[model samples]
Target: MLLEFVVEVPAEQVRSEVEKAYTVLQRTARVRGYRPGKAPRNILSHLYGGRVHADVAQRLVDATLNKALAEQSVQPLSQPAIAPAELRPDASFSYKARFEVRPEISGVKWEGFEVKRPSVKASDEMVDAEIAGLRRKHATLQSPDPERPAKVGDVATITFKLEIGGEFLDQKEQEVETELGSGHLFKEIDEALIGMNAGEHKDVRLTFPAQHQNPELRSKEGVFHVTLKDLRERIYPEVDDEFAKDCGEESLEALRASQRAKVEKELTQKASDAVAEQLVMEICKANPIPVPPSLVDQQAQLAERELLAAARRQGQRLDSNADLRARVRLDSEMKVRAGLLMAEIAKEKEVKVTEADIEKGYEELAEQSGKNVAKVKAEYRDPKKRELLIGMILEDKILDMIEAAAKITDAA
Candidate 1:
């Protein structure tokens, strides 16, 4: 929705600006054969007339365009492109600026969209599994009973010396504690460790491919002399009163009730989120409106940054992937379009982000980040970050309104 925004400054205002610009320039501008503030108007015009006119024209445009836009209630998506217009004495000044504005949205079919709500409940088995997982997560390593052989699921501490291609890779044995079946050790070595008793030594062969990631191991045949120093088993605790107390619960019954409630709440939130997402997609499809290229570009940049950060975390590079970047740009365009639709929907429903919502948002951020409320507030003190937070709050409010107006069906 690019429109030409034209504004005409009266001749009197243009003359006033011209005089003001010259007055300021005359006070400080240096010229031959004349002291500052003592040069004649004609001389000053001859020396600095071009710069002064540009300055005055820019000043008049800046002073009047904002006022005109405010009076017309035109909100541009980004900065405007204004062609430089000449200013003449005893004549009016006018300039036309072009920029993207929100397209007029009409006939938006946004009500009573169909969505499916997943009906989820925590069963006894689910609760038991969850408690069992908790116990395993808190499990400890214990020495195996009867001094048996090392097997999968057991932690093995071993020392091994490697010789590759008729050369010793390590002058001394390397000691490492690795869990069997966890891929921490080489596949062949892990397989060789099974059914091995403590203090037993074995010799194994290994081959490295040319395309291997490590340069030292590439295209090499190797041998490993392994010694199993010890074997330990992972022991999970029993679900009793003592376990419940350790988990900050009064008893086993209380722990079960708490886990059931937590699981139920999680299911409810998931269903709500799914429904909202479906409704938003439907509404966006119903009303396809033109979105500004600048907004879409901003979204694409944000997506690219997020992708780069994720790649860095996994020790990978994504900058050279043109296809992925192109796909990201395509996805970002749709996100921008959907976001514009949601904002319009929010305006239509009179959905507002209140002070209470902001306070609640701050509190939730603090809880999620394990930081205090004051620190979270301080971190968002920058105007841009605070505005981003408010935008998120507004988005949530709009989604809630959409979900409330949707026709949701319960599903198993």
Candidate 2:
């Protein structure tokens, strides 16, 4: 874990640094009966004692550490721990730095791996389902008769208040519009809404699922006081050429073709991802590379931040749950290991990311996000972010190479 580096600058360089430090002190340090920038070196040293030497030593260590690491091609995961050393006026400066370097992964077997490639053809049934979904999206909502009760496939507008443990929950009385039996609400609540007429009130009790996203509400029982305010039926458009035209297609055939193409593309991407994931799993199992604790910890922190951001986006509060943190940490460790192995493979294969690759990456991002290239570039203004993007591009290229060299078999 400790990567040691030794750097010795010539006496001439040490003398130059000492003189520079003295010049700076003379301009900034005040002494008795001496004007600024006019103080002698001895006089400044007398006033400042070892301060000048300490400053010069620090500067020399910083400069030498960078230069030595570059020359030796050594990259550390953290700041180097420099051993304490004295700076003498007439001697060469020498210092030792100890730090943690990324673990070296050898004997990576990324080629000739056998993987199953799933067939990803789109079917007519899939196209029909997609078109049906489009028709439902364009459906019209009409108010049901006042005497009619809410039923499945009808949109119900309701105002509900929740009571947890017999205490009314604050800010729980809210109105929502949902289709009956749509699973948007709890199944019990959705069922209870059926056969309820407008202005009718009922109470539904339910227990939250164990795997609910909200940790506090998971497996908890609560009572909902519901009032059905209105009911509306959805009238879906007919699936024909007119509907296809409404969907920006010339004819029904064109619409189905477009949907089929979209489905095929999605399935192909999904299959590729599955193959890639399996390949990575196989590589990791074959080559058990030791991951650096620092890298794992860094990745874990990043994962935690992303999780918190996602929770905030959904307007949910996530408490400091130890179980969630542990799960995320474990996932992060695995990801870090996979990433290290991939990088090692990339290095061995001389897989490099060119300027054109980065530009293409940015373009793809912009296209997917519906943003301008300039906007996407501005978002990656941070140096670390830019470096991460380039690294990702390189990793992807390496993955492509691996897939090409892999022995693929059709999945049964």
Candidate 3:
């Protein structure tokens, strides 16, 4: 429910606030003929009449709006939009405030839907890939033969100067080591780097992709002057008992077993998350409700903050991109809609997060963080944070219930 109404502060209340304001000015304002903090009310009002009346009117409007909202049982999602109006010393002040309220939802159908549950089984190839990734992380870098040209797997150490549209990119020569054909550099530059031996210098011209990370460089032609300094290749240790032991396993077979188990767990978790997201998507599609713009904006701001924090962690800048903000706002609206739909489903199903559920959540957080339950509880001392945790737990419970009641089918 959105409420739009006008309220007037009575003349007596206005006059009382004016007197209070005058009293404050009396102590703060200095008069030429009077001692400091001893100015009379009439003199103070005479000097600061308009300012006092404006301040008093603002205070009176805020107080009166609160009182009226309480009296009318109106719960606003955002701050009330008060219309601009003049405040006079002779009469009551009136203004209109418009705000939105939470909409009532009922009879949300969230269960008995058919959703494809992905069948995920860990394979030998997947386990091998995971193990290979682990090995790559522990691989040693060895200097390659200087006479040999750089290849796809070789890491080339280069000092490069970049120019876009004949303008130098940076003042200093930038040194970087990148694996050839890794897609980290522009395709043209990567290809040009390959077949270049040590002490080789080349000027490569290329156009940046339209979706380049830097908005200013996107779709722009650039020239890279690169000098190949050295070449290095990664050498992986042979997968044997020693490697297994290095990975904290007893033997090769034990390491393979552990890798397989880890792969299975990862696949299972991925499949579960996919199914849960699908369930929420279906529920939201089936039961469409109007989402308040204020809530959507709030969620968008939160999403923006989270995205900015993530970008900061990656040492990437995104604050200047309007496109990123628009994308975040769109994604946030979907998230807010899904959350509201889930809340309605929880309400309809009479599902609630119990104390035990919250305790279990705390235990899970503790286990993940390697902290004790007491420390976790202490960390979440804010009541609002605790309430948010409970809300998340309740949403999880609702998802579990829906998943249990859903008809599962294997995806093709």
Candidate 4:
């Protein structure tokens, strides 16, 4: 952890060095009370002498520190605190810095590890369930069982108002009908509405969970006045071969086969991704390196910004009152860990993204983004940007290489 840098001032150059700095300040200095390059050197010196002296000292220190660090082979993890001794008007300023250095790591192994890959294939039943979900999405509502109270899987119509401290935060309305469990409405209102005969009214007090997304609403106790207006449950008819034909399938078996095939394709991609992640983690575990906390913090900040932008795009407002710093800190740590782990794996495996690999990645991204491949390539034309994309591709290739070496078994 020992890092030392020397400050140098040549014996023959002290007077010239101070004069050079003074000359530059005279030419470049801009004072509010005087025109640029027109102010008297003595007047400027008198007006901003302390500030100019500090600035010049810092510049000289930065230049000397860089040279000293190079000569001593020392690297600092943080900015060095500068505390230079007072310099006489005729003497050159000089100072030295000593600080802790990041620990050096060597002789780490980062290859030849195995991981169990989870197997997932869409079954005939799964496909049928998905189709049923799609049908529900397209289903029309109809009044049924008017005599029964609301129950599970039944939609309830009720009028409710949110209150805080016995005063309503929501608009004051005698009746505002809304479906329970829809949007941000309480689930208990649905419970109370269900199985209740029409015209039945009740007031339910519910406590919001501490982890609620809205900081203002979190841990708040509010009473809801609800009146049961109506209740209805979804009714799904039998799905058989005839239903499959109506759904544009030759037969129920064909529909199930198609659904299973689709699921298998999706699962294959997912499993591949999971396998790559496991391999990277294994490699990183074997090859330990001290990643910079600053880099991790930067990654986390970028992620948080992206998340906020996405929320805005989706018409969701992020609460300024929420403790996002804690969330960002956790996210940044994870990202840093993953990055370090993958870097180790890439190093060990000699994994690389070839020109063709980058092209293929661009093609895939273009397809997903519904943009022309040429346009996508044009936007990422910079060599530095392309290298970053190549790194991601190389990481994936390394994961695939590890996955190929592993003995994968289908999970039940």
Better of 2 and 4 by lDDT: 2
CA RMSD per model (angstroms): 6.1, 5.4, 3.7, 5.2
Residue 405 C-alpha lDDT in model 3: 86
TM-score of each: 0.69, 0.74, 0.83, 0.72
- The residue-level lDDT of candidate 3 at 201 comes to 97
TM-score of the candidate numbered 4? 0.72
Consecutive 10-residue window with the lowest summed lDDT within model 1: 315-324
| lDDT tens digits by residue: candidate 3, 333-383 | 777777887887777778888889999999999998999999999988899
Compared to the true structure, candidate 1 yields what TM-score?
A: 0.69
**Given candidate 3, what's the lDDT at residue 139?**
95
Comparing 1 and 2 by TM-score, which wins?
Answer: 2
Residue by residue across 69-102, what tens digits does model 1's lDDT show?
A: 8888998887999885688867999999898887
The model with the greatest TM-score is: 3
Clashes of each: 0, 0, 0, 3
Give me the runs in candidate 1 sitting further than 4 Å from their true place.
Answer: 32-47, 87-91, 123-129, 142-233, 238-242, 249-257, 303-335, 349-397
lDDT of 4 by residue, 73-151 (tens): 7777666666675654567567768665554554445445667657776775778777887567645555565466656
Q: Candidates' lDDT values, in order?
A: 0.86, 0.86, 0.84, 0.69
